[model samples]
Target: MREMTIGKNDAGQRLDKFLQKALPSLPPSLMHKYVRLKRIKCNGKRCQTSDRLTEGDVLSLYINDEFFQPVKEEEAFRRITPRLHILYEDDHILLCDKRPGMVVHEDDQGTLDTLINHIKAYLYEKGEWDPDKEQSFTPALCNRIDRYTGGIVMAAKTAEGLRVLNEKIRLHQVQKFYLCLVHGTPSPRQAVIQDTLLKDSKQNQVRVVKKNTPGARTASMSYKVLQSRGKLSLVECELFTGRTHQIRVQLSHRGWPLVGDTKYGTMERNRPYGMTHQALYSYKLHFSQEGDWGELSYLRGKTFQVEDVPFLPFFYNQPKN
Candidate 1:
């Protein structure tokens, strides 16, 4: 049995929806079964799956406490696959490529082997940072990229570096740019999307509102057409405000969702490779930190992308000898 206390962030969701968001790997049918069997109870009482839960409610889940035995095939693949590709690194910052189909981090599992873990490992491998508890180290990643989106990431090596970088970002000294392949060309080649977003805790989904709503936060981004290939229009995006799913939501709202983004794009547009992760890549970052502002007036960069994939041919042009 596992005990869970509802936090303010999860207050407005249905019991089943909350369970799904909390335990992503567990199937919904199994979660419902536990609810029906009263194996899952809220406040020590049987609650239906549809029961609405508020903040401060205590939930108890009765589960089989069995050790996870890895399947041979899954283990074999897991061993072969490495997450997070390193693009560029220095004493102050590290750049990496985020891959699709991989969650950057698991909120519940809290494993040490996510993209963030590999990043630290990459740092240690280069003899730049020591992650050992015995030695003093610095915090990393001035910002994190979403798992579904492929792009460049910036990480700080020293605590001082982190502080300076964070301040610069807050002051809008850093610029981030992305390359996305969308289905349609936006009416205006260059335009800004300004809207408010509210996250639905129970459904684990976010809603974009044009007007004021509870807990809504403003988001803004600009897009420009780069190149068009067949049905796909390659576009460049720049963010003025960082918000969850800002690019996806804004593009989808404009009827030009990124290619392969089933969550935001229409099924009709998901063709060729149906329902694949959106072909979005973070291509550039410009930073102006305080401490090393003199030595490095601005840090401009790019990350290495895997060349094995056919979709990435345009970016990887040189022949490896």
Candidate 2:
């Protein structure tokens, strides 16, 4: 059983329609049957097919046990050609430029290589990784870049380093910057986007909500247009509140989808460039840890810039076809 509160976007919408959006994996037939059997309730009252939803309505749903399963995170990292850029590294942390077409971790068996695997291999080769002894140290990435998107990726060598970095990220103390190429230039050149996002598991899509939306989480980001090239524009993005697909969804919502982002932007818009995957790079990161910027051993007072990709090295490796 699960409970959700309706918001402004869901008001006046049919109960069935609202349910479909809230629970993407549940079948319409199953929902209908549950509603017919009075297993589903709105505001503690049985809802019918014609029941219209309203803001602040409380919904309760009964789902089967199949939906609940224990998740096992993969730990094995495969060895791939080290095609990454080593921007900075120390005893406690690693700052590397992740390349495109490399996954951070593997999901299935006998599959493609991942960044974690390669990193593990590198550490082992350097006598940095040893599991047999208690003193053996392994590297763990605190943040990730999309498999198709390349940029600065962070990793921690010690457990304390991981804990500190993860905490700093959670507290928004770590500043992350990204360079991206978009289809069109935003009018304001600089602005902030605040919205709600709901992921459709079945379609593997995210629905951006301009107003209040049920089951949606608030996400926000700040962006500035830095340069323009023909129909494309270079933009720098700073994440205010990190949410899944926040940058992609917000840019797409503003009608300036990232270049080469086939899922969000128009294919015709990318035809001239013959590109795939948005040209985005996590170029810089700055933060003060333990309230002492100078005392921090790892990447303090440091910046990473990839000099290869022209304006943005992570994306658009070669000009359009």
Candidate 3:
């Protein structure tokens, strides 16, 4: 038998729904059976799964220990020394500042110490995650920035937070903005760049291709000049459609490749700062959705911006305000 108390954040939800979150590994049929068999109780009394829980409610589950076992074949990554620069955090979500050179997720590099691994270790140390107790739930990053682009990345602490964050991203409710330093001056000061981009998987690079070209996808972004000094110009770009390397390829095709982006940009301007990665940063994220966003409704109409850009001063005579 295990006793659990309902906290204020989880008080208003129904019993079954709360159980689904609390015991993620337990099957729904088994949960319903526990309620039907009176093995689950609230406030020292038998409670139905439909019962609405209030704050200070005491819940007891009289069950076997098999439910607490770790998931088979779902191995948890071992804890590492966490190195995260957290910008904001709440009960359900966390906003972290990712620096350059950190991989967002596991890929061809086999379990290289990544931001996700750091987040898991941090959460585990803080008691926000339980590998032995949780069946399938793992705290994960909701949004991914490229390995070398430093900026804000969203993370979810709970299952509901993760679900809602993904939903908002899918619907394009979460608006993103990036800042980059280009080598040459772009005409008209402000305009939208539209082009079709093709990705070369073998080379890990993207290029602008003709409209009728095979495997080409439409990519577009709007940019406004933030500041210009000498041969460099700082521009702010907002993506109309999210594509892999969309901003880099489209902007580079217009003859203003980002500084230190040797993949597309010329390496002539890559000096002075000895920069290894691009000077592009995902700087702002605005949450302006129309409808309800479930657990993240409080984020609507809000904008989060990060200002810890490492290469801003090197490109411009005066830093961008």
| Superposition error at 320 for model 3 (Å) | 13
* Per-candidate RMSD, Å: 13.6, 14.8, 5.9
Off by over 4 Å in 3: 1-77, 318-321
Q: Report the lDDT tens digits of candidate 3 across residue range 97-124.
A: 8998888888786755788888888888
User: Which runs of model 1 end up more than 4 angstroms from their true locations?
Assistant: 1-84, 131-138, 288-321
Q: Whole-model Cα lDDT per candidate? A: 0.67, 0.72, 0.82
TM-score order of candidates, best first? 3, 2, 1
Which pairs clash inside model 3? none
Question: lDDT at 196 for candidate 1?
Answer: 85
Clash totals for all candidate models: 2, 3, 0
**Which regions of candidate 2 fall more than 4 Å away from where they truly are?**
1-83, 108-112, 134-138, 210-212, 289-298, 310-321
TM-score winner between 1 and 3, please give it.
3
Q: List the candidates' TM-scores in order.
A: 0.64, 0.68, 0.76
Better of 1 and 2 by TM-score: 2
For candidate 2, the per-residue lDDT at 233 reads: 80
